[model samples]
Target: MKALDTWERVLLTLIALVYLAFGLGIEGFLSPYALADSTYNFSEKALIALAMALLVVAGEIDLSIAATMALCSLAMGFAMKAGASLPLMLLAALATGLLCGALNGWLVTRWKLPAIVVTIGTLSLYRGLAQVVLGDQAITGYPQTLSTWGNGSLGDLIGVPALIVPIEFAVLVVAGLAVGLLLHRTLHGRRLYAIGSNPIASRFSGIAVDRYRMGLFLFAGVMAALAAVLLTGRIGSTRPNLAMGWELDAVTIVILGGVAIEGGRGSILGTVLAAVLLGSFTFALGMLNVSGIVMSMIVGGLLIVSMVLPRWLRLLQRGARPALRTV
Candidate 1:
């Protein structure tokens, strides 16, 4: 356990240091304004990626998370249109997300279908539903106070408002700590690991593998909902197309963070660092006026490299082992 903890910390530190270098490099070479604006997306997207990291670590994936977020925002928009209170709108958004999660979980568990298939079907289904709810209409003119949740930054420091932290950053930090603890310091977490590593063995060991998978899907759903709330507040509008393809971004970050896709092996610290790294990378590229297509290419290349390198290394070692035995 201690070794594993150390490894996790090491990986996180390595990513953090890489970001620090990149941040400074960009600051020295580029305009300060570029760095400042970059912080917003880096921070906001990091929060969304957190839930995705956890879901992947548990050996399941939710392709509909992006769609779920969009739907949640639509629900909040409907609530606002109905003159609902801010708190009530928040509840509606979260509840809608939970229901989406529960539906996905039920389909996957009850029917014993592959999660990828279930989520892919729901990804289109949920986003389609969001479009139906909004129908190319924009939900604008939300309450000013509610917008503050996403847009307000502390301006006063030392008798003056000086770059007050964004609420999204606070959410990211809190969510990171919570997820880190939940993954590292609980029996339920160990069970998740067991199930991910070997489902059959976990079942024989009396672990309720299906229940655990369902719970993870549910948790991810709620987190995605929370992300939607933040996004809606920040943008001051709800659109059905919001958060499209975010599921892939989350998966990229998870894999880049060193989470094994086959499950049973991963760390929250690594995922958090990878989230930050990816965000920083995107921001830096954007500052250079890189095309969106190029950015996507870079991200895709990284994901492929991260996934394949470890397996390639293992294969090389396996081949060497046979040679040694023959010798």
Candidate 2:
């Protein structure tokens, strides 16, 4: 806890305040079941944002993640309509994600294109494909298992009739823990920060900077696919509009998690906490029946503040340090 930076500490405190305030002010907000269920609203986005955190930390960004989700969901829907079983439908989605991720990675790494530009182009391409396939229609008929996994509670799955814990939330927590370990406990993670901080130096030091970038993008695709599956199941349909504008939310979660926009510095713990903080705060407002448009505005504002505030504070600290030395 002591090692946590200022931003992370702020996140923790903010989370506590959100929970406390909402619990007291909103009816049922503190109910165990309600708390668990609220997590469902943002679990998929948080899951993808975890993957997005890695990419942002490595000094690259993927604007096409939401589009990737749209395409993957359509792939699943198409497979299901063609009489594919549950596993096969899932495979279709994963395969689509794999191809999209590979393409994004290749364009950025092999062709020396800027990641932001590449992903933005692919974003349109992927969404265009989804729109072409969907075309003012919705796809449904997903298996019952999909619904159970998406909407059911852990208690429902395990036969605990009295317990009402959301399964999706549990999955998010597990995923967050795994990402934290990968970022903080592994050599591969170190190389990512090295490349992000200075790719030229890392390459000169024999680190495979391009390889890491490509791999990060590839993994981003898979996570986007997973999020797509969860979202499709939760909504019980797939459409061209699925996960639209979510790239902004996903990026907000990462940047708000304290990952530097320019790359090089961040922690998985900060990201997970940021997810919780954002989710809890939004969930509270949602209980008040706040408009989705307002929610999005808050998300956008938070993104800007998170990016700018820390740098400003750091500058103030540096100036204060020099004055202290003079004294």
Candidate 3:
């Protein structure tokens, strides 16, 4: 039902068409194994997208999230080099993410700076710190278990290829469900919509607007850090370029999912479905040997279409109804 909402239906249809087109044209493209494996392509960015959705719905944005991930991964590397255990390494990344997020939140909420401006500054700052620290080097040789878990699957663990479900995909699903519920079902969620729609009115009506904004930004940072953990685990190393340029991808997926860039109109289900659509699109293109340049063009074109089509349809639907009004 969630995926069948007015706009979400369109996303589902697109996803289906992509799979059908790719499946018909590319051998083995529709195989369960292949489809399941594609989750890794977008899982990390999608995780940040989920948190970013909440922030967007609350009338804020964090362009520094990818940078946060880079910094977090670098922190994890530092911990590993210091002989931290696996859990401590994970903690290091998360704490760094939280700190970065808190800084953004503080700058925006306390100093009354615009969120976009604050995050953009931090984005450069965070990534620069990582680049400066690593300086044309990478940190590697993490504990083997981290790599195993990063690339492992439920089916792989159980030794059943037929049950193939990427552990990353499983985590994404759980997070999607959790965030969807939080955004759609709780009083706190309702307040976010209220805040985005009219922050002054919501504040006058007793909502803790700044508090929500701060929390959402913090949440965005933590999710990005979690993504960093997974990505580091997968590659078994920390590179300055890790997750570079992912913030745009995350925002693009959120917008494609039908969230209003201005705020107050979107759903987690739509964002999650959009994420799946993108993963499938990239996977399909890769299967058909589509060049990266062409694929980027196609994706950019789709982003434009997603932004315009709804407004165009709304205009068409208006149908000059003002003339039918009885004065």
Best candidate (score: lDDT): 2
* TM-score of structure candidate 3: 0.94
- Estimate, for each residue in 6-123, the C-alpha lDDT of model 2 and write its tens digit: 8888788888888888888998898887888778868998989988999988999999999999999999999999999999999999999889999999999999999999999999
> Candidate 1: deviation at residue 252, Å?
0.4
Task: In candidate 3, list every pair of residues with a backbone clash.
Answer: none
Best by TM-score: 2
Model 1, residue 73: distance off in Å is 0.2
The TM-score measured for candidate 2 stands at: 0.95
TM-score for each predicted model, relative to the true structure: 0.87, 0.95, 0.94
C-alpha RMSD between model 3 and the true structure: 2.4
Angstrom error of the Cα, residue 157, model 3: value is 3.9
Q: Native-vs-model 2 lDDT?
A: 0.89
Checking candidate 2 for backbone clashes, the offending pairs are none
**Ranking of all candidate structures by their TM-score, best first:** 2, 3, 1
Error of 2 at 134 (Å): 0.8
